[model samples]
Target: MLHSIRAIVNGSTNFILTKMFDENLGFKEALLLAQQLGFAESNPTLDVEGFDALNKWTIFLCHAYGIVTTPDQILFTGIQNIHKSDALVAKARGQQIRLVAQAKKLVDGGVAAFVLPQFVLADNPLSFVKNEYNGVVIESGFADQQFFYGKGAGSFPTASAVLSDLSALRYGYKYEYKKLYHHEPNQLNDDIYLRVYVSFTDVKNIPTEDFEWIEQWHAQEDRKYLSGVIALKKLKTTIWWKENGTSLILEPDPIIENIEVRKLKKKAWNWLDYCRINLI
Candidate 1:
C-alpha cells in the first residue's frame, strides 16, 4: 500500500531558502542569519550540504518501507550551489525551491530515493512550508495523500518532541517498526531517469551530451541554464556538478520511469532510421 514519502527534513536549509525567497536575500546572508539565531550550527556543513536530510530520510525508509540503508548509498544534493538568480527564476515560473527528500517504491520491489533541491509548484503543499517548518507528504494506494506539518527547529520544538516521547513512555507505548519486522522485498534502485534544471558558469563543464533530451536552454554572458532529461545513474556516477559554480535542481514531476525512458529511446531510433532511408 505504501507508495512514496516526500519531505523537507532540514529546517536550517529551509530557513535559508525561505529568506532568499521572501526577502530577496542571498544564500550566504540567510545562512548567517540562521546561525545568529541559533537555528543552524556554526559549522553547518551537515545541514547546508544535505547530509542532515539524508540522515533523516535514511531512517524514514527503514520505518516506512523496511529498507535499511546509509546516507552514502543514496544520491543527494544540497542547497550550497543555489543563488539569488535561481530563486528569482523559480519565482518567475510560479515555483519555489526546496530541499526535498523523497523515496518511492517501484513495482519491481525496489525503492528509489534521493535528496535534492527541487522546484515545487505554487499549489504544492511544500511550497507553503517556509522558514523553520517541516512538511511531509505520504502517498499510499488506499489513503491517497496525507500531510504532516510542524515546527522543525529551535529549542522549543526539540523540547516538545522530547516531551511527547516521555508522555508516550508513560502510556507504555513503543514503536512497532512494523515494516522492518515484517520485511519487504525492497532494495535501493537508481536506474531511473529525471528531468533537471542545471545552471552553470561554463558550458563545457555542463556536459550536454549526458542528457537524454534537452527541452530548454538559455545562454547568457554571465551564466547559462538548461533543462533536460538525464539518467539518474549518470548523476550518481558524476561529480562535475559539485565542482565550482554549478547548480542542479529537479524539475517539477522529475521522476521518469525506466519503461518510459526506453520508449523515448525507441522513438528516437525509429526517427533516425526513417531519416536514413529518405536520405538514401
Candidate 2:
C-alpha cells in the first residue's frame, strides 16, 4: 500500500546461508549443492557476492520511487567473505546471519538503501525464512508490517515470473513509476546511528575515537566483538579491522550502554546474556 518497501531480493545466497545456518553445512558445500540443484548458476558470481541482489534492488527502486540507478551507485556487500566462525558467533547469540538487501524511504525525504550482511535476531520473522525462499517486508502508514515469504528461486520460479510479465503485456498493463525525480541515496551514519557488532583478530588496529561510545566488547586471541553505536557515514570510512580479518554485523537495536574493556572475557554470550554492569 505504501510506496516504500524493504525486501530480501535474492535467493541463491539465501539458500546457501540457510543451508549453512539451518542445515549446518559449510559455505562451499552449500554453494556446490545450490549449483547442482539449479538454484544457482554454474558461475554464481552475481548471486553469491550480491551483485544479483543489487540488480534486483535497482529494479525495486525504479518501480517503487521512480528512481533509476546502477549497481555501482549504491552501497553493496555480499556473502562471499562470510566465514563459519561468523555464523557460529551469530548462532551462539541466538541470531541468524542474513545477507539482507534493504531499501526504504527516509524521514528526511531521501532514501536509505543498501544490500549487505546483517545479523537478525531469533525473534525477527526474517530469521525463520530459509532455503531458496525470499522474505520481503513492506512498511508504511496504513500497512505497518507486510511480509511476503515464498519460494523465490529456481528455473520454474524464474519462468513463472517471466510468464507473468508476458501475461501483463497481453492485458496492456505495465508498472507505473510513482516517482521520476531521483535524489542521492543517504550514506550510512549521516543522520541514522546503528549498533554494529564488529569482530577482528586484533584490537590494536581498531579506531576507538570514531564511535560515540563503546557499549561492550568480547576479546579472544583470534576473535573479538566490539559493540558500539556509530553513524552509517563514519562506519564506511573506518573499516580498519578488515585488514586484520574483521567482520561486522549491524544489530537490530542498541541495548548495551557504556562498558569497560576490562570486563570483557575471551568468550561470552551476547550483551544481554553477559553481565550488563561492569563489576571491576
* Best candidate according to lDDT: 1
- Where model 1 places Cα greater than 4 Å from the true spot, the runs are 162-174, 266-280
Question: Weakest 10 consecutive residues, lDDT, candidate 2?
Answer: 254-263
RMSD of each: 3.1, 6.4
**What is residue 137's positional error in candidate 2, in angstroms?**
1.0
Candidate 1 pairs with clashing backbones: none
Predicted candidate 2 versus true structure: per-residue lDDT over 1-280, tens digit per residue: 3435656678889999988887788889999999999999999998987898988888787666666677766666677767677788888888988878776655554566667788888877788778898998787788688789988899999999999999999999977665554533333213445567777776777787777557777785466778876666665565463455566666754222223222332233345445566532
| CA lDDT, every model vs. true structure | 0.90, 0.72
Cα deviation at 26, candidate 2, in Å, is 2.4
